[model samples]
Target chain A: MLSGKKRGLQSIEFLQAPIISSSASVAGPLESKSSWAEDFDWIMEDYLLGESSWERTETKVLQQVIQIALDKQQLSFEDIEVFLAGDLLDQIISSNYTARELKTPFLGLYGACSTMAEAILIGAMLVEGGFFTRLVAAAGSHHYTAERQFRFPTEQGVQPAPYSQWTATAAGALVLEAQGNGPRVSSITIGRIVDMNQKDANNLGAAMAPAAADTIHRHFLDLNRDSDYYDLVVTGDLGLVGQDLLEELFVQQGVVPKPNISDCGVLLYDGIPEVNAGGSGCGCSACMLCGPLLKKMYRGDLQRLLFVATGALMSPTSTNQGESIPGIAHAVAIEI
Target chain B: MTPDSNEERKKIEEQEYQQLVEQVRPRPNILLNCIWAFIIGGLICTLGQLILDYFRAQGMSMEDAGAMTAVSMIFLGALLTGLGWYDELGKKAGAGSIIPITGFANAIVASAMEYKREGYIFGVGARIFSIAGPTLLFGFVAAVIIGLVKYLTMLW
Candidate 1:
């Protein structure tokens, strides 16, 4: 039989397993809901850093945010037990280059845009499992860098379709510790990878909506919790189209939550124009996770939240092989 | 003997100067050069558009086609450079010929061709890798290091 103190400690340990103490994002004014554009030309001229590549921009932003966390917490890079990150770059350029500037051990992760939640869940598990006490999970995306690698350079004058997602140029970082009496990560529901065989890249919202709905539905079922329990449920970067489709899909499945469900892609580019649909990139959710959401959490504006970062796992090689893009979503629930 | 030598040297100097002037005279027509540059640049972009259309017709995704366009431009530039056509085009258009995607392709091919004459092991092979080698190296190294840091930071 365990002593009352031991039992209480064990319960606390489980409750505080993976706590997200803080977060931040580096985005342009458009990403912060200050502007909006219906076409890509406006974005090319007004939103982008015409001089620097994505790698440089992403690294600079990520370094700045990490520096803030380090300074605020008075924690040294060497003291961070683990650094987990992901990005859309083939080799995860932002995380890699940024890591070169830091002293912490790194873990390169790639789950497309769903990387933040994935990293958070993994970091939480490590902390809970007593593998490490302090873990930092960060992710970033640069419009130019992602464009050059996955699309075309801005100088090319390529017109983006309406359904196309504007790659959000930003980075997000979260520092997780085992000691805090903060809200603990109550449950994490890993998503099933869903491939809908949709070839139209422009219609990524439609391609990814089913997966988002599927994951959220399954997650709620697994935890035996209603959607109303959480104040907000956020999905990575599904944009306007995916959000609508997700709502409709949920209705069809007989699970209708309040309109409190939001998408990072849609919210990140609220006022920003020229981005016809909205922000979608590896950093879309990464920045959101670190920015407004973290600020709200710290302010006690949110008590329980579910962050589901989604990724469209489509590669040049896979597309070349005539394979349709498969989608993945990972959900991490945090309660304070 | 001194007077004759002086006269002979002056004649030689004047003749050499005139010959140099003749050698420096403009040969290529400026208008023709501009025309070729415009035509070549337009043609390259047209080809790129055609390729993009073809890819899209084949049901390739827009993002995929966008990426393919860049690759296609690089290859087209290399082919033109190898055939000595790009040099002629460059001579005519100046920066106009070099500003587009084809220009990067030409640079890579030209660099490789220039070094290939040196030898296979030390010249061609090594030099071919030199042009984009740094970009590849830096990109890869940066990614690996970031991965390592992320791994280490996650460890307790």
Candidate 2:
């Protein structure tokens, strides 16, 4: 009864089965110091990466990661149908500049931190629907670039509050092809903008928790499957607070998530005194999924996993004007 | 559930969520942070004084030497900020690194460097004063008020 093209209200069951051809993850110096340091293909010597500005450095990372992904697949930009990417900067300058250099047809996206999943979802759909043969999905965020744009300057010498999550300086690029030997993208659940009237920018975890849980619950229901169906269920950079909130919300809704659920923000860093809550930004889940998670799937450790990338959709102007933060989380079921 | 009850439930859930977050949030060691701040702040001030003394010994007036010292300290702070070293210093010293003129310089340079990608005119020029804007605004207003008060006192 539940085996159809459309799932309930939000999810789409991919019958054509788009495959991930290859992926490359690149991280900055601070992210390299994380627990999964060795996972990244290339770790820059510094945040700037010998670039003049943080934004440019982020663009450089995107370019490098895209090239790496393309190289890994033994494909070039001409082979890819289109490149989809986004970042934390205003108008997504990082992805835009990288697009200019890539010379590939590009569609810029903005889902805050959830851009990764959003891109993957759209790319997979395009590939599965026979609209495109090879598509590249990329996203990134720089700590310095995001800090100045969203909160404060990195060098302001301002001590971050406890609830504040450290913005990750990294980028990830994934090449999704119509047919490949890589993991199959089976389903995608698009998230709705969920606002719980929470406005604290420093506490993004709480603001994003409800949206993540809403999407996860919807995904499972739409697919007519239980939590035990997936090998793992992961959320984008919700850190420790959002992880706890997600678990609580699921319990309240009588929806039991898989026991292997983990937050990329919590997994990246090891309870460091510097990063108050944990690692965050568009790059957090992007790098983790492209690197360690993909490797695990390739090694047959994880067969079916739900990758949910969550985002806090808030702007400086909206925040200053006392607007509540709207959060979104898109889920893509990846199977090998 | 009714729509009103759903709203009520959401409010209760929000409150409970806030409480959970607060419960797990880490509390900073205030005493230790204060101690580090005091020591580092005092050392920085001492360094400023030594620079002022050196300038005074080089035959500059005390006022001029004081001004030069402020300028030099601001430059040092901005330099360290550009090099991305001041943040590391801030990690250990806390507010000690920020409660000085150097902190003000760091704020301006950091903003300028951050927004430089947007373009020089709109980015650097506009956001250069983002952090220091309030301080400078109030400082100028206070100066105007003090000048008016001094003039009134003299007339009296």
Candidate 3:
């Protein structure tokens, strides 16, 4: 029913699928050491990025990644109609400050960790609905910045719970055009707020699992497709705990996706013990989509891909106030 | 069903999901954490004893030496916290580092350093005691209550 082209309840089958022209990912030094190092366009040697604050560095990383995405396409900021992006920081400052420098008409988003997929989904709809010609969709997160804002100061050295996730220090940007030579945004399943009344902030993977399950379930039902539809189904940042729970949830909902399903949080850090369970933050799925998954599509290793970024929609204040964490997941399908 | 019954069903459902999640949530090993806390905590006390003996050997009284040990331990903790080594030790040591005088110093220094970026007036000055404030408040109240009890018993 959405955009008048869908055969499903909450999806839009883009009449002319917008092409992902170019994508660029930047990683901090810590994340650069991961197995997917080659996927990123730039690996910052330090978290500072020559900036005094981590917030400034995060903004710079996103700004530079957007520029790199444009450069890869041989286009200027003026050529882009709008910039849609978000980050984990409060007020979406990283996206806000970056937009100030880029001087493009900006629409800031705040879907917590779901910002990446949300941006791409909305950008796709706008382009397909004949609102914009080309635009940049991006999301980023800085490890230190997220730490200071969400949990503790960078140097606190507090012993985290075993199931806690590490925030990824990375940024990813994609140039979506009306027509291009890259994988296409075939359709998207907009998700609803799904809260199971879970309240543990440290165990976010558990809190967010049900939401991921709900969205993926509705996506399958809406498309009238089974589990094997996507060659690869990746959820954003639901580490080890959430990954296991999601598979179990699918069984409960009768939406048993194949074992091809993987979580970006688990894959992003590659089982690094320092990260505890796995990686998180907006950058988790953003980098995965722009870096490794998109690369696989280009190489023909993957055809249909489901990128679902799930977010725990609760702030530190709400957590402190003993409110349950509500989770949301948006599923974006890409095909080559 | 009535609205009240519907709300009760939802609450029960939420509790059921929480129980299910609890089964899957990995738990920290209590035995290992306790052992680490004990051993690390003992080492800190030993360090305090060493400091006390050092001051006593310099011809100080037992009370003076005890006070000096507390000062030395607090200073060491503050120094380590400033250099950012206290937190690293705290991670492995757990309550071992947290229960000692050094750990007490760290609670303040860590908060101070964390808020230092927000500027001195509202940041460091106000929040330096943020982590340690509850402990100080309760500890003082407990001391006052004990003092009152002792005085009342003496009068009796």
Candidate closest to the true structure, highest TM-score = 3
Which ranges in model 2 have alpha carbons more than 4 Å from their true place? A1-3, A271-273, B1-9, B48-72, B115-125, B143-156
Local distance difference test, each candidate = 0.71, 0.88, 0.88
Clash pairs detected, candidate 3: none
TM-score of 2: 0.89
- Per-residue lDDT over A132-193 for candidate 2, one digit per residue giving the tens place of the 0 to 100 score: 99999999988888887788876767777667898998889899988878999999999999
Residue-level error in angstroms, candidate 3, position B147: 3.0
Give, for candidate 3 chain B, the lowest lDDT window spanning 10 residues: B13-22
**DockQ ranking, high to low:** 3, 2, 1
Q: Which ten contiguous residues of candidate 2 chain A have the minimum total lDDT? A: A251-260
- The candidates' interface RMSDs, in order, read 26.5, 2.2, 1.6
Q: Model 1 off-target regions past 4 Å?
A: A1-14, A32-53, A181-183, A257-259, B1-156
| TM-score of the A-chain for all models | 0.88, 0.97, 0.97
Q: What DockQ results for candidate 2?
A: 0.50
lDDT of 1 at A225: 67
In the range A98-128, model 1's lDDT, one tens digit per residue, is 8888867899899888888889888887887
Off by over 4 Å in 3: A1-3, A257-259, B154-156
